[model samples]
Target: MSPKNYEIIEHSRGWNGYFKLDVYRLRHDTFEGGKSAILDREVLERGHAVAVLPYDPVRDEVVLIEQFRPGAISVQKTYPDMPLWLNEIVAGIIEDGEKPQDVAHRETLEESGCTIIGDLEYISRYYVTPGCSSETVTLYYGRVDSTNIGGIHGVVDEGEDIRVYKVSAEECFAMLQNGQLCNATATIAVQWLMLNRDRIRKETSALRP
Candidate 1:
């Protein structure tokens, strides 16, 4: 049994800001009949994004941004009757011609009001929701100093109302355990940090020579 090959015959734009129609001819081989079959499929044009999990080893805190999510509102009636807002890590869509690392740094500052001063550690890149959406997100980890972070931050033009919270790693873990934090990105990042907690602490503690 060999892999199937697809050939695109035609494509067109869709209503949701992506390619809608795609005519594909697939080639496959059958062992029993020794025959070939053709199939068709369509794909959507998706965009890329970036997410940053900013950690402050000195304070043992991770920065989280809180904002109201419309999607949450639409689905809140299913369970946990409450507001549709959420607390998540600093993240944003990668603008055209912007590097992923740069976008991570930019979104960190925009959402957390703190500057990242350490090396940007690449974590993992993943599809946000593969079932219906075509959005890929690159994740990164960076050390930041939250010593003087106190103020409202977020893009005004984009109608972003973000509140920054500097909570200890222990508290973040507690939130995860208590069901207070349910965002996927935040959960993934925090779990990663939990796994590498010792190494991150040691690396951040080593003095520059």
Candidate 2:
């Protein structure tokens, strides 16, 4: 791909604690010709996060977390008669000096109260939103025991109140089909599980002779 001509003029933290504004000067290279442009862009530098889809091949279940999001409150007011909370995979931002896999493992424990055993399979990495934000996320798949999970778990200091659920793979798939699962990260993680369910089940079932 050809490189686009763009220069960052200035960047600084915005009034909001979550984002920064970036001023840029650009020379657009359209198919027909080139055009000079100057524009300001807001970039969210929340940094990278990790999302883990914990699946139990033995029981054919998937672990999910349900939580109330302040971001969803505005949309809930639009309906005025429905709940705005969401069900999503265990996710957390990468802490300083923390690896992505470590973040996934730590979040799974803190959010779901389940230990992730065995290797973590990488799914994909992509920008959550590129239009005006710079948040990138890494997705992964791993195995967890559903039998030992119970009760709600979350970091109180961060004001997170999360409920953990262990639902069958079939049920999770149904939720995805019926539009119940709406978040992009959860959708991608669940779909990845569905695509690899059979193979993962078979491989995980067979042990070394």
Q: What is the TM-score of each candidate against the true structure?
A: 0.83, 0.90
Report the error of model 1 at residue 72, Å: 1.1
Steric clash count of candidate 2: 0
lDDT of 1: 0.79
For residues 1-209, could you state the per-residue lDDT of candidate 2 as single tens digits? 55465555565666455544554444455555564466666666777899999899888999998999877888777866545778899999998899999999999999999899799999999998898767888999989989877678999998889999888999999999987887999999999988999999899789525
State the weakest 10-residue window (summed lDDT) of model 2. 18-27
Error of 2 at 30 (Å): 3.7
Error of 2 at 116 (Å): 0.7
Estimate, for each residue in 1-209, the C-alpha lDDT of model 1 and write its tens digit. Answer: 56454444444443554334333454555655444665555545457889898888878888888898987875777875655778788999887899998898899988888788868998899888774556788999988987777567899999999988778899989988886677788888888998997898888778645
Give the range of the ten consecutive residues with the poorest summed lDDT in model 1. Answer: 14-23
How high a TM-score does candidate 2 get? 0.90
